[model samples]
Target: MDEALWAVGRGTGVAALVLFTASVVLGIITRSGRPLPGLPRFSVTLVHRNVSLAASLFLVVHVVTLMFDPYALLNLLDVFVPFFGSYRPVWQGLGTVAFDLLIVIVVTSLLRNRLGPRVFKAIHWLTYAMWPIALAHAIGNGTNGVEGWFLVLSGVCVLAVLASFGWRLSSRFVEFRSVRLGEIS
Candidate 1:
């Protein structure tokens, strides 16, 4: 049972990583105001949201499974308080930090309408910090982080993010302002 829980935790962690990577790439695409092949421009944002939700689900499962797995030795406090775990405290703490930041991002996004665009956008920028922290957690804490297969997976994810980020910086990216001050009347 412990092994099963550990497997689920590890598997979900990997899944969350991949989904988060996709979310980041799609987010870059959405910001560029360009439609994916056969996708309307607006649909890109929908896809990004769905991917992020999926990643969140997987992350939740990963954390929950770890909490239940005796091998992991994680308690509720460890889940919330960064570096509070006895098992590889620093590495586990990174995951906790990433998870907490994600929770903030999700909550702010949900209250975007009530919070106003300025506040929402400022909090959304935390995604930039969240991704790298999550990646570091995976590399430093994952049991298979140093394995060949996991390294390859991480490499691909990194390359995809870098390419997307480069495109985001490039002038070739078309900017489409979803909101216009003049139109606000």
Candidate 2:
């Protein structure tokens, strides 16, 4: 039973990471203002929102399962309180900070309308920070380390982020060209 729970927790964590990667990619593409041919804007937006929600859900499961795992020796406070983990204090603290950032991002998104567009957008940028913090936690404390399928998954996540960022930059170049052309015209 314990093994089963641990496996499930690990799977959930992996799934959450993958969902976050996808969210970052889609967000960059959309923010570039370059419409994807044949893809409705609403559809892309919906996918981005749903992916964020799914990532959050998986994150919650990962945290809860770790707290319950007797071997992990994590308590509820460890989840909420930064750097309180009895084991691997520094690395574990990264997870706590990441959790806090995730909460901020998710809450702001949920109340985006009430928060207004500018405020909501500002908070939303925290997602980029959250990604690196999460990545650091995974790298510093992940039991799997640089082995098996885990390395491949991490590579994919990194590639997705970089690729999206590159696309956004390229789109900006295109926009600049168009603007220059208009000015000349």
Candidate 3:
């Protein structure tokens, strides 16, 4: 039963990471200058928003389950206070830091209109930082990290994020090339 609960927590963490990566990919693909393949621009935006919300929900589950896990020995303070855990304090603190970043990302996104575009965009940039921190937490603290299935899942999530970032970079390059050509022509 303990193992099962741990698996659930691990699975939820992985799922949330994947969803967050997907949201980032979709947002990159649907940028004003980029060409979104089949889906309408508005639809892509909507999907991105929904996926981000799902990721946040999964993160909540992950945190709650960790608190319950006997092995983690986490209290509410461990969730909010960085490095309070007696075991693996530094790595544990990384998870707490990631959680704080996630909260900022979600809150700013939810209140995007009220915050205004500049503020929202600044807050949203923290998502990039959150991803690496979360990834580090999983690798450092996850019990399932050594298992085959978990490894594959983590690889997939990482690859998806990398591919998305690559695509965005390529798109920017293309845009720049086109602009240069136009100027030359």
Best by lDDT: 1
The lDDT per prediction is 0.92, 0.80, 0.80
* Candidate 2 TM-score to native: 0.87
If ranked by lDDT, best first, what sequence of candidates would result? 1, 2, 3
Tens digit of per-residue lDDT, candidate 2, span 1-185: 78877877778888888899999887775564445678775567777888988998999999899888777778978998889898787788998898899999988888998999889989999988988788778777767646668888898899889887787677343433354357433
Error of 3 at 129 (Å): 0.6
TM-score of 3: 0.84
- Estimate candidate 1's RMSD in Å: 3.1
lDDT string for model 1 (16-115, tens) is 9999999999999887677899999899999999999999999999999998999998899998999989988999999999999999999998999999
Q: Which runs in model 1 stand beyond 4 Å of their true positions?
A: 178-185
lDDT of 3: 0.80
By TM-score rank, best first, the candidates go 1, 2, 3
| Residue pairs with backbone overlap in model 2 | none
